[model samples]
Target: MQLAVNMLLKCSESNLIERIVWLDDQYCYVVNINEASFPYQLTLEEVIESLQNETKVIVEQDPFVISVEDHELTEAELSKREFAWAIIQSIYVIPAIFDSKLRAQLIKEASEDFGVTKKTVRQYLKRYWARGMTKNSLLPDYMNCGKTISQEKSFTKKPGRPTIYDSAIKRAPVTEEWKKIFRGALEKHYFIKSKPSLKYAYQQMLKESFSKKDFQSGVKVLDLDNAIPTFDQFYYWYRKWYKADYVVRKREGQREYLKNYRAIIGSATEDAKSIGVFAIDATIGDIYLVSTLDKNNVVGRPTIYLIVDIFSRAIVGVSVTLMNMSGESVRVALANCFDNKQAFCKRVLNMDIGEGDWPMHYIPHTILADRGSELISDSLTSLTENLNIKLSNIGPYRPELKGICESYFGILQQHLAPFLPGAVQKDFNKRGGKDYRKLAVLNIQQYTQILVRCIIYYNHRYLEGYPLSKAMIEQNVFPTPIEIFKWGLSRGNGRLIQLSSEQIRSNVLPTGDATVTAKGIRFAGLYYSSKQALKENWFSQARIKGSYKIKIQYDPQDVSVIYLRHDRRNYEVCHLVEYQSMYKNVTLEEVRLLQLNRNQQQADFEHVELNYQIQLAQEIEAIVQQAKAEDDSSLPKDIKAIRHNRKMEKELLINSKYEPNNEPPVFHITPIQKNKLSLFQAKQKEALDDDYQT
Candidate 1:
């Protein structure tokens, strides 16, 4: 019944009322060119009833009959000439025709009845006896005749202006001089960023065509006699000769014009099997979301990472985060794609999905992404290599190459984001009515849950105008993306490269290089060491001449621990030390900010030290006066000032006691000579006695 209704709707849409008509109340009359002699009359009520009952309607065959054997022939196997002879011979075989007085009358009647020319009948009768009535004898051989020429061009004149007009026009209207000037103007105007108007190009052509030069004797040389073509004439010639160039120049700024207008000779998605090519990309979501930790704090738009299968158009993985688009987000999204989504839904959202509700949980054979810094980092390359997945980047600014993933972002924004409270309007004018930031109610977790539900719904729901798979097209059915994926899987063509949780955690996480110091392995200004690292004496080992770098994988969301690849198959987990444990739940961004703050504080301390050096004496005097003013022991004394005063007094007293004298005194060498010892010994003994007295 629905099929009939749909057919009726199509017929109405196509304006086929004359061909399809409702007759009486029970039947529908269909008029067809091939069925002119016998029209079709279907019982509409009976068809609908049969459809509702899930039964078939049997169609009967026509009763009219005709055969060539009804008429007797002179020869069973007759060629064109023999058949003509047979028709002529049939007149005599009929007794009534043989009895006719005039045989010409009978032959004429036979020619009319058989729809043949009398001339052809006569020619065939003339050659009948000589050809022995055989079918092969009447066959005409074309060995003597050459190849046939096209009738339309056989008598037509050669393409070019006639000689009569050549002399009259003298030279062509678009001569070599005209072509030179027009080409120069076109190059100056059309093939440039300014993209000047056609009228301006014509003006330029005129300017170049007419030029003047100053002579050395002050006489002017000018070419003002040549007539320039009108703008319309130039436009006509340009349209005829350089239409493609004009189109290219007109659509220069539109990237899609090149993609759509130009011919693409190679297939991008057709060569891949289901789950063969996965395109990953990130976009800022339209709706605003708050931080999960603080409901009142609005984090603005979240970055959404999408991983779409090129073949099935299925969104295999998605990640919604307050973090910017970076390698970390890509890693998390890829891990989600490789891990079982059923388990993920249960663990993350606490919602149990049915078996195979989300069937995508395998690494793609090839991953396609844009040349974004986040997607093209060393970590992603290393991860893809470890997973044995090929990575490719599309040309710059060519989103159409990764169109499957790019289009999904728009689809989600159009259909889902607008319905949310904090949804941002695409047009600035539409946003004037409401404050979208104030409307933000969903946190990152809540938004993620909504995103998951939306992905599931998109997979299951039917999408119109989706390209049908080969099987679906053959079966005359339309299926959703998930259905197409399942169909491909059932045909045993889709590949599922499943990975263990450990494999995913090790290979899909972002990686960085760290060095083992005597204290521990330091990475990102923080030290991390495990019991296993200590047991293996990694720190005590001698460092190489350059950097003793080791490969480590870490989660950006948690800086507490990092995984060190100790051997081919083992990864040891190393935690931050006690002093750095405060960074346990901190993000990588926070850690970097904290390091910047510490460096800033150290700079501030150096600035203070410099100021103190310039006022050293004044600071000492201030400290001494403050200490003397607080003389009462019961009162609270300035301990810091007192310490400064004591340090200053000690330095002054030592300076006075060890003061050096440059002035010369009266000769004291006489006393040394009178002594019983050498002059040097006497002086050393005198200096020792003075030191003991002091």
Candidate 2:
């Protein structure tokens, strides 16, 4: 029966239970556990038959069947401890059967076999019965029988003789009167100095110990005859108590201690959801780039503006330009973040990207940036207010607050920048052997494309130590930035607030004040008025303090056209004047540089014009003199005629102007001047004829 129960328990443990089809009569049927066809059938009759056969075998091999002589020899071969333990185990196996005689017999047998006394065996048996009859109950409790003391008593301090310091002090104790003397000495000779040394303080203390009167007050004082402590004792005690205090006093008004010793507390962004917080920062890229328009012109290192999502540490947007860090770069990067990046990737790089490749295209709830002039502008403030985004400017020197973006910059320099030509090596000495500037090959457009690809790879690549979502944790998988972003959105925890392209342009673009004139709207020394802006008499409005100055938003990369904010909800596109086509493709920086050049040229023109005006005045005066000579009756006819000709030449020179066609204008000289010129010619011809006749 026990063997059958064991067999059934084993089958149940292995999940091999089958249904019992029939429980009575000649046979009992059982089906497979999983209802699958089985090769052999299991039944209760077979189990009963197997149990009967096992019972017969157990009876045949029973211990009672063994001879008494053999059992006794086996018992005698056991060791003393083994025999003792066996007796203890036997007494507890069936305590009811172990009567007085039985117990005595067991004790006698243990004593005879193991040499243990009957009295000890009896005691062991008594202990086993009194306790739970376990193996541990039969063992001795050595803790109570040993000489070990309690932990608390052993750890307690024992009273002993006085310490060495106490003995030294007993030999020559420092009295209160002696301490007063030391204080007086310190105040007079040590504390009064700019920086007092301990040795000098000790000497002063010794001197004051023998002084009769105080320095400030001429009064007699008690002298320390021989009770003064030795300099060694004084110095030891001073260091133990007053040394730190003195150092602190001497170091007062110094902030270096605070800076070096203070602990810095940091903040975290893990609690924020995707798109809840963003950190925007700019850095000069380590690699140099050539201009796309002119290869010879090294545009220098481009400033890369990066916007990172604080939660997933994902790069939301990036913009690289030869231009310096400004509000325009910030605007462009943020616009890319808030607008669809798929279209941008396609339009700019002509790369087909899936939806999950770069899922970030939403405005963040809050933005954190350094206190740069470009970031802290009125335009950013206005845009943030309009978009309902909270803008926080971290204090200067607190790069840790925006550590995510700062770390990303380092990662870019270490990982991506090194692969490109003209990449500035981190160590200056490394570049001594090679000129990195000369190695530059990529133009601005190619660099931008590479940057885009790098950003995409960073987003998709697996980042170690990335926090896992609940589902990912169960699956034992680490998530990447894209995974986190997607999981966060699926959980409905992300604030995926998207903005249209027009809305992003209107909000993220930098704004400037423009005055609308009759011809057009003049902004940045360029006109940008369209037919729509001109219609409705927008420029003819009253010239209040800022009434005529309309608010205009523009893309700094393209200055040819700007958007005029007609109202809170509307914007009008304004283009540059037709004559100002030179500025059509110019950037804001280029426009500024152009304006500077124009100002310099204007100054040069003014200088040249001043001298030309003075010379023209002199020429006009000479012409007037020549005209007066022509009318004078006292002057000779030839002289008058020559003067008249000079006047006519001057008039023609003043009247004619250079033309693009390079054709000289036909000048009609006055009738009087022409007759004077013809008479002069005829007199020359008559003189020639008279000379021939002579």
Candidate 3:
């Protein structure tokens, strides 16, 4: 190997040698780059012998010796390099410059000629030789010239430039205590929910903590003009503690930051290289819907859940219901993704479709969604883990992360919803606007059918400017979603997984707590029964021991059957009870809605029921008042005598009504006879019809 200049040689584990300058075939110059050492001559033969014996190894070239471009140099740097080069131009070529005595004399003379000190001239020569003897190495070290913030000296008074507008008002010093105050004020006033402007917050801080109340023009005013830590001082510390991005997130909220302020850098296709990646989201439909039971009863806007394949931009799943965007809706939508498309389209839309028209019934490898309760739930997490699918929840309020699914809602609203009756307008909340809710004419089922047809049209609609892959372009594939999907499968690019309905339900269904009641297994206000429950006598045990809670997994779309989970693998299928057969095909949302409507109707009759109860109480009070007004003075006061008189009166009244044979006997109570009964007399009279009933 050729021994080049600036090559680092490791003679041992600790010591390093840099070949600085070449002298001759017999002698070469080297220096210890790690430590300060004088340049010395070494024998080329010795270095060669060390290399051959594996004693010294060439590690790498020194980084500082790399050539610098002329354009990279500043004017001042270029001038300095030229000046230093001129001073050492003649003496560096001579061999005598290597001698200590000769080098010192030459450097002294050059320093005098250049009007620089000998020490400065010697430093320039050392830098040049150490940096592979390049002219660029003599440039000034301007990179390390400025003093950093840490290197700045502490100040007694206010730092930075003096104010131009107010010279008399001396700015306050920002002490350690003031910094603590600033932090507390910022967190309390600026970063709080009522998000105030920074300037306003500063003024409020001064008024609340720093200033005293004073009267000005007969009005109470806060004397903040002479307060310690001026706005400038407070603002300086604010910038030090919070960055612009953090300030926006803190004051405006994280949702606002995600919606507007955050950066949009990546595409949905960045990680979705094939059709196995799906994006799922839900939105409230713009059009209001009525109840399927009664079209006159306006239910509300329907929640529409959609799952889109990121690779082909095709919607694979859809669920429309008069429910909120919740876990139930998400589960229903996800279950729909695995349903046979041919049957689903015919059953729901009432329109038959060929297999090629809407062909998507595969479990996705990854499901991307927002941090909704639907996706971030424990049941969903367990389902994804069991199914070997990755559940990715994007940041909160970041709909842009799953743009394909979010944009589909807008497409539906723009294309289908606006033309429908009861569709909401943007200015509906404005003054004197017509109530869009009153115009609702379609029910949930009707609206869902219309939505399904629109989805079918969207799938077949040709994409004009889709970003097709190289293989797709070469294959001359049509830009429609179905065509793109077929093309991807043909090239073996988009691999998908197919699963049976039973398998999918076992892994993907959401679970809840169901009670084993004496009536039956009660879940979502419906009753269910199973042969296993009967064999195990669960209901009898529940009746004897009182009802208890059990874990169960059920599909929200259909309440006809539910799975009783014993473990991960074992699940007992339970059918709806015979008594609850009316609600056999009802959804969990529909059941809850029916319960809510019944509750409202009960509430409507509450006032009339309360009035009836009040009238009954008033009648009882009137009768009690009339009885108290009667002649009770003529009756006996003694307990024994009163009981005897009442029994005689009852018998007399009974005899007069039944026999009518003799005149009814009249009994009068005498005051002298109203004496208490003696114990012996009471015992004696107990045998002869002395039984008194109160």
Candidate 4:
């Protein structure tokens, strides 16, 4: 039967008898053995049988058999041990003895040339190749002292097949038992928190002689402590067991390291500046402010719709109203921005959500936003085409890209929000979450009021980014965008700004002629048109113009065609237009129906225009009827003819005493009457007349 053992050795014929004793497996009784000169492996049974066959006397001497124990392994039967010993001895050799021919240079060359794995080469070196190349640095002659091996209990050579008695599974030599534990038992754990080196704390702990458990636990909490490997023999076990994966070897010079670090940091900083770009987002607004000056108790916060100018960071336009942020604040804010210079917006403006696509009117350049879904709201995309913005998103993890608006809000919160008297706050629990991104709402009024006050400060204050404050003031760098507008205008800016619009000349005020007054002066949508206009049913359409600042008016439909009367262009020329805002539809039947509706509506409104021709015809008919009733004796034919002619001419002209004459008297030519020619001519005429009378 074959058997296996952990180690093996070989010896030659002449030394075999001395190296081998009988059929034992555990220990060979060595008398005088030259292991290198006589290399051989022989089973214990072969030796025993050969000895029996050769000798005259057969003596059975299984001397002093000692029991051995090791990790619960029982000794195999004699037959197996015999062969096992042969196999083990065949592999055994002096631990550090190497073949003379093997050289470190040759090993290195072979290792490189063969392209062998480091592990495999390491195994070869450990097993068969390293002895000749390595230095004997592991202490003294003690390293190879066979006497020392005999002195150690683990290495004691007992009789045939002695059980491995040490119980530590055939113990390592006393010289290396601890090293084995250090290397094997406690290495290679990656700790969660890095251990800090605490030289002073360690010194104190050592002085106090704290137990190992106490030391370990205490060291964990010290902040200044560093993960330091042991420096003394006391730490030898740790050196082998818990050796750090990384060792910090201090470089002799920092110039190269600093230069490389600077280069890396500089490269990263430079690249971060320009790579990802974003587009500006635009939003229109309508707002209402519950009059702040009013003493009445208000139910809700005053609302103001403000159109934000993302580029220069300005409020492009705004309107105050008593309406919700959506229909009122949002629309009004948008209205102010889209209005005619002198009128409120007559056309629809655009807004877009951040999704890359929107309807044609909804298209914008790009939207810069965070992960919030409202930033990509679908309702907001309704007019994306009108605003030229784009959809851009920052990486999911990055915070700096969306920092512009955040930074602005920071400024608002710091300088403005606190001053607001009645900001409302709604906790997240109350949000109900239908709108996933509703920011915690606070009373918007207080903050908005502060916002209005702060905006002037924001605009006019000398900004650090703009250096020359004096130059800015002198150059009017901080003019309100309204004053800065250079579009359509008449003579003076103040006239445009300060003109008292009640009295208009030329029957034409330069206002966009979405409306006209009774005096024939064209105005924007707001004025009271004539009572006569009411007869035409102009009032049937519930149109109302801007109450205050700029000119704007509304129609139930057909919002598209309101034109600028002075320039004679559709309102579309001014800003982006809403398509469905117009009342008109394309079909001819629709048009006819609209006209009929309009006629009926106009006639039904405040007043109506009575046709002059119809009235005149009725008057003439009345006269004819009266004459017939009078038996045709009312007048003669010639007199009636003249009177009828005069009456017809008057009716045709539709003259009234109140109407101004088209022609004015000219003084350029004057021929005096004979009596009034001159004082002398009058006297001569009087004298001649008197002589004639006499």
Best by lDDT: 3
lDDT tens readout by residue for model 4, 484-503? 22111111111111111111
Tens digit per residue, CA lDDT, model 3, 1-694? 4454444567865566664454444666676665534468888788878888878887643444322334445567778878887886745745677677898888888888889998878777777766545455576666447633444355788888876786534466787777788888899889977877888888777767676656555644555466367787888889867868688878888768767875443334445766668899888889887765556778788888999988888889898876677776777788889777787655444557787767777766678877676676545654554343677767766777788788899988888756799998877889999899999998776777787778888888998889988867887889998777666544333435454455555555676899999989999888889999999999999999999999888876557789987643356899988877776544567778878888999999999999999999999999999988984863335565587778887989887888667777666656554444355467556644544532
| Residue 297 in model 4: lDDT | 22
Clashing pairs in 3: none
Q: Write the per-residue lDDT of candidate 2 for residues 1-694, one digit (tens) a residue.
A: 2121101111423444333222222333333323332113345457566447642121111110111111122223234324556766554433322345665676677778767688877766655433222233343443235454333222122123434554312225555565676666665665552667768888766655544676668865445443446666566546644545345544442243333432222223433644457889999988877654456656678788888887777888887766777777888778777766787666444567776677777766578887687876556664664454667766658999889899988887778766798888866447446677888887655777788777889888888877665666875544677766655543333434455456666557777898877657888888876777667665665333234677788766567688877543466788888898866555565566556766888998997899999999999999999998879664346554587669767765655644555455576778986897798789878887898999
Question: Which scores greater on TM-score, model 2 or model 3?
Answer: 3
TM-scores for every candidate against the unseen true structure? 0.43, 0.45, 0.49, 0.23
Model 3 alpha-carbon miss at residue 40, Å: 71
Order of candidate numbers by TM-score, starting with the best: 3, 2, 1, 4
Please identify model 4 stretches exceeding 4 Å from their true place.
1-294, 302-329, 337-382, 387-400, 417-450, 465-535, 538-694
Overall lDDT per candidate, in order of appearance: 0.62, 0.61, 0.72, 0.31
Shift in Å, residue 666, candidate 1? 62
Candidate 2 error regions (>4 Å): 1-267, 270-275, 287-300, 321-329, 343-357, 370-386, 390-401, 414-423, 426-446, 473-478, 534-548, 577-586, 598-694
**Per-prediction count of colliding residue pairs?**
0, 0, 0, 72
Q: 2 or 4: which has the higher lDDT? A: 2
